[model samples]
Target: MIKILLVGCNGKMGTMISTVAQNSTTLTIAAGFDSKTEGNFNYPVYDSLTNVKENVDVVLDFSRPATLDSICEFVLNRKIPVVFCTTGYSAEQLNKIQGLSAEVPVFHSANMSIGINIVNNILKTISNTLYKDFDIEIIEKHHNQKVDAPSGTALLLANTIKDSIEAETEFNYGREGIAKREHKEIGIHAIRGGNIIGDHEVIFAGKGEVIEIKHSAISREVFAVGALKACEYVYDKTPGMYSMDNVVNDTIKF
Candidate 1:
């Protein structure tokens, strides 16, 4: 059985993952860390990673990027495997995560829904194969509490699509009063609303036709399963950077 230390244990995703862990005989919650947890679970509750023992097989994070440095330090110092499902990291922070991958296994995914990731893969392949035939645009809707615009997942889709297009060029976050769509520019729009779980859509437009591919997540538990899957994937792997793409065992489209 794999033991998990869950970060952000007071949040919705954390609670969902806990329930999932409780149901699975192959997994257990070793400990949880949260700034706002009201009380204890069956296991320990910690407010600081420094106070927590590195006794678990894996650490799963769904917290803010602000907490990343401390978490990375904990993982590196403890030599523990990690699955980071949080979004909103700067490029330098991402590089830092990659840096630690040289010493300990790490998996990070903006979207932890396996089916959504598979859709991203297919979008990459199609964009690469049909660059001239399509004009690409992405729109993502997330919960109101989400801070980032043009969600990490939407960017993942757009970036994957860009990777496939040979002459792929620019990423346009949104359009204004008088803008023209460049053939190479991929458009991304972000929507935040009340109680929305998650929704993503990729539009492929051409002179004569249009195609749209979409994915909607109804529950946070899907991401929990994905995080758990990442734990399983990186358990025996070398210390290196990985994404859900790697966990899903699909070739990088580009």
Candidate 2:
């Protein structure tokens, strides 16, 4: 069994992951770390990781970026693998995560949904073909409670297109001011409303046709399930950085 130290255990995603783990034969929540320590959990919840006593094989984090330093310190000291499911980390914090990967297994993904990762792969395959002729635009929708604008998944897809085409591309977030659209600019739009699980749409507009690829999450459980898959993938691996792409490649044949 993989014993996980779940960070942000009181949050929605944390609770979902816990519920999912309860049905898994190979997974268990050994302990939890959250500022709000009191909860209706089968496992003990501590206000800090330093207070955790249970032996854990991995750390699954869905907490805010503000907790990254403490989490990094804990994982480094323990030499345990960690899966980061939180979004909105700054470049410096992301660099810190990359640095941590050199010492222990670190899995990070902006959107931990299997379908999203597959879409990411598909973008890579088609970006080279459509980028030169097509004007790309990405639209992402999430719940009103979401703090980050232009969800990480949107940026991920934009970056995928940029990298695949091997060209300099600029991102335009929600255009205004009546400027003509630049040929090399990719448009990104964000929508916030009531209880949207998650939605992402990519528009590739060409001379005569527009190709739109979209992924809409029906429930938050998709992310929880993907994060758990990431947990299993990184559990016994050597020290390195991993992503949902790696997990998808390992599990999906085509």
Candidate 3:
């Protein structure tokens, strides 16, 4: 069995992951790290990684970016692989994550849904074929409680399209005042309200028509399931950085 040390175990995603692992045959929760340590769980929940009492094969992180420093130190010292499902990290924190990848297996992604990963791949193909004649715009919607705008999945889609076209594409996040759309710019818009799980739409607009590619997440299970798959993949991987694409290729077909 692969023993997973789940960070942010008391939060929504953490609880969801633990609930899923209860019926898992190959994966088990060995320990958890969270600020809220008062809870009834099959495994022990520590106030921090430094307080964990059991050995674990891997770490699954859904914690805040503020705790990243401590997380890096804990994993580096133990030589353990980690899957980061948290979003809204600054550029400096992202660089720190890249630096840690040189010493231990580090998996990070803007979105963990396998469906979204497949959408990323499809967008690449579509962007390459239509970018010359079409203006690309992305619309992403999430629950009001979500902390970040443009959703990480929106950026993932934008970057995927940017990579495929091999052009100097600038992202314009919601316009202000009066300005015409730039040819090489990708417009990204965000909507936050109600209890939307996730919804992303990429539109290709031309002179007379438009084409849209979309993916919608109905629940948090998709993310939890993807994180488990990432844990399984990174358990024995060599020191390096990985993404959802790597996990998808090894575990399932597009």
Candidate 4:
């Protein structure tokens, strides 16, 4: 069985992962760490990863950005493999994760859905092939409780597209004061409302035909289950940084 130390185990994802682990013969949800809900599960829950005593095969993270530094510190010191499912990281924070990759396996994804991974690749291919001829735009919708606007998935998708095209596409989020569209700019829209899980649409505007792609997630289980899939994939990977694309492309496999 793969021993999984789940961070943020009391959050929505934590609860879902715990429930999934219970039914899986190949996985064991060994321990958890969360400030929000403690002592609610049979496993021990600490406020930080430092207090975790189990020798886990891998760690599944679904926490916020605020806890990233501490989690990295603990995981690096312990030489533990990690699968990161959290979002809302700055470039510097991302660099920190990159730095940790030199010592331990680290897997990160903006949207854990396998379908979104396919969408990301499609965006990359389309951008590489026709970025100069078409304009790129991304719009995302989330629940009202999500603190970050323009969800991280949108940024990751935009960045992947930009890198693939190498077109230096400028990003514009939420227009204001009579702003107009620019061919060289990519517009990103964020919508927040009641109970929505996640919805993302990517539009490629061309002269004759406007091609659009979309991915909709109606349940948190999509994310939770995907995180588990990541855990299984990255369990014995070589020490390095990896993304959902790695999983989708079969570049990082168990």
* TM-score (C-alpha) between model 1 and the true structure: 0.95
Candidate 2 residue-wise lDDT, 1-254, digit = tens: 99999999999999999999999998899999999988899999999789899999999999999999999999999999999999999999999999999999999999999999999999999988888899999999999999998899999998998888877888888977897999889899999999998999999999999999999999999999999998999999999999999988987865
**Candidate 1 runs further than 4 Å off:** 250-254
Q: Considering summed lDDT, which 10 consecutive residues are worst modelled in model 3?
A: 245-254
| Cα displacement (Å) at residue 68, model 1 | 1.1
RMSD of each: 2.0, 0.9, 1.4, 2.3
What residue runs in model 3 are displaced by over 4 Å at the alpha carbon?
A: 251-254
lDDT tens digits by residue: candidate 3, 22-88: 9899999999999999888999889967788798989999988998999999999999999999998
lDDT of 2 at 149: 87
CA lDDT, every prediction?
0.86, 0.93, 0.91, 0.85
Q: Per-residue error at 94 for model 4, in Å?
A: 1.3
Candidate 2: residue pairs that collide: none
Position 63, candidate 2: lDDT: 91
TM-score of 4: 0.93
Q: Model 1 clash pairs?
A: 128-164
| Candidate 4 lDDT tens digits, 1-254 | 99998898988878988987888887888888888654569787787677788888888888889988888887888787899888888889989989999999999888899888898887766787878788888999999999888898888888888788775678888789988788888889999999888999999989999989999998888887788889888888889987778778885232
Deviating ranges (above 4 Å) for candidate 2: none
Residue pair clashes in candidate 4: none
